[model samples]
Target: MTFENSLAFAQEQDKLDPLAHYRQQFHHPVINGQQVLYFTGNSLGLQPKSARDYINSELDEWAKWGVEGHFHGKNPWVSYHEILTPASAELVGANESEVVCMNSLTTNLHLLFVSFYQPDGKRFKIISEAKMFPSDRYLLETQVRHHGFDPDEAIIEIAPREGEFLLREQDILAAIEEHKDELALVFFGGVNYFTGQLFDMKTLTEAAHKAGALAGFDLAHAAGNVPLHLHDWNVDFAAWCSYKYLNGSAGNVAGIFVHDRHGNNTDIKRFGGWWGHDKERRFLMENNFQPMTGAEGWQISNAPVMGMAILKASLDIFAEAGMPRLRKKSLKLTAYLEYIFNQVVAMFPDYQLQIITPTEPEKRGCQLSIKLIGSDKKFFEALTQAGVIADFREPDVIRLSPTPLYNSFEDVYRFGETLRNLLSQSHH
Candidate 1:
């Protein structure tokens, strides 16, 4: 729909939103008793009201049972992370055995790399996106260095062409071809953290495999923001944190997915721990590691019960709402935000407002990366002071994500209005 009468359209759409009631489920931050227009779900999600109850239940268990809470708690702390696996697997489109909630994102990435990134002299290079998350870059560089390879020679960064904001699929394929002989692994963000550009996982994985390389994804920004099918797509492995779009608390549990095709490959090495041992013999404490089948074998430590409590609450909500239903509304909500941004851009022809996120719904998540012309840090500071809760990337990009579960149509409309007003008063 066009935006000539967007203000009226927004009001009407908000009235029709079936998921509108979900907004009240979150505890929105207040500024001077006014609710802010929050669009930073890409960073940290809004807190669920059930989070308090979910966490308090665990707290009560700890208080009452003391050390006995390990096995006697309400949710059974002995296998707390298992409670989240089915829901998380369903959300990411994986089989039950293929998924397991575990350590944080980067930690999982490193662990997965240890098994997937086996570099020989003939296949010693790794290809990744040019501007991955800072943590990911550090992990990759350190991993290469730890393997006695120079980061400069072992890492190949696929960059966008000059003046382009996002990488092209063809360019990525060509890079794989160019490095086929030496490339040991291919790693890319499922949805780029900065640009919100959703990579074509199936196509990328196909190319990586054809080039004799393993393909893995860092799904930190894509996990709950977009639909993924790791098994069908033949992705070797994937990792993601739960805090961002999943509505789990910050630094909460993360997850890993390993396709069942690799289940019998016993030669693949990993950093093992007792938690990953076979449940039948775990209590024996023989010091002999017998890794569990599938992704659960990747676990290195006992599950954090408190964090898993928060994740369970969030997943319960997701199971009730369903990702398919949530994604349908997410597309329309984000598209409406784009439509309004375009409307504002049309009003001031000289002002440049380039959306770095791909226009196609299939190529992006709910987040939109906006590049403002002739603006700086002060511009975003002004936006923050004005009660708009968007995030600013370094240099000159602002990202706004209207979360489907909690963000309403009115929130998108109000954000557009705030941006327009913020621009109107700017010195530029």
Candidate 2:
């Protein structure tokens, strides 16, 4: 397919897009009189227009029935989370029993580690990619310390070969094999937040199992952006935030996936709470904790109805769009974004911008992290002033994501146009 870097071409593509209508479902922010080209859905997704009604319904139920709202509301706060199970499961390719919407990202990671990241004497070290999201690093460092082990000794951080920006698959597998004897767990971001690199999850999970180590991923950037098969891949465990690509609202409830093997394991200990207990006996409130089967067994507290309501509104749209369709559109949309950037590069010629994200579509998602040559945050500020909503990582990377659900081909073309103008001005 020949790609065109023109407004007319973009509009034509948008006119033909099957997912184009979904854009109307979100509320875009206005800068002057026009809506800004939002590219930070990789951070906090745009709110679904229906979010208000979904949340207000919950508020209304609470106002009407007070405590009885738990069981009497239209959505039934008692089992509100169950409503999202099938769609949420479909989003990440897991069974309903294998996944659950629960605590926030790091909190869920800790909960998962409690059962999976146990460090015995012989196999105590954990391996992960270097320069991952800071939250994950902090979690790994503190988790190692909590187990009476020094982070420096217990954590192995893999980096790309010098002068490279992405991790080689072979290097990752080699590291896992090298440390197989001492490896207790292997964790990675499904789609790295800064680099936007989508790690090969299935192979990594296979390698971990071959090495007798638990494999898990922080899918904060990968969850809704990519089509995942967590259950079929035999991934041991995974955690993700809903706010990013899931479009579940800021600070929304996160999700977790525990494979059938572990989800069914009654012996695996977890941080128990009343919410995780069997629903039939939950009101009984026995002193003994009887864990619910599957990922639900890891829940720690009651559901946040408001957050889940906003999440439900977003999930409904996703269910309607379907992950396969979303993934298909995303690949083409993201590729066009890259193509536009390349066109800008040729036009500018003076700026040293290079896309740090992998050129391979399968190795990336919607984000294209550009390494802006010889520029800093001020460059990002310039783009922001021009109504660009991209994220700037320290040093020199501007991450622009053209989300298929909300962003149009016109949006991508306009962003490229804005960037070309900005870069040309900077050069002058």
RMSD of each: 1.4, 0.9
Instruction: Candidate 2: list runs displaced more than 4 Å.
Output: none
- Scored by CA lDDT, what does every candidate get? 0.89, 0.93
Writing each residue's lDDT as its tens digit, candidate 1 over 1-428 gives 55433567777887888887888888898986788989999999989999989999999999999988888967778788888999999989899899999989999999998899899888989989999999999999999999999999999998999989899999999999998999999999999999999999999999999999999999999998898899999999999999999989889899999999874454569989888888788889897788888898888999898889988888998988888988999999999888888877777676777898999998999999998777777878888888988999998999999999988777777777887887677626
Q: Pick the candidate with the highest TM-score.
A: 2
lDDT of candidate 1 at residue 194, scale 0 to 100: 92
Q: Poorest 10 consecutive residues of model 1 by lDDT?
A: 1-10
| TM-score of each candidate structure, all chains considered together | 0.97, 0.99
- lDDT of candidate 2 vs native? 0.93
* Candidate 2 TM-score over all chains jointly: 0.99
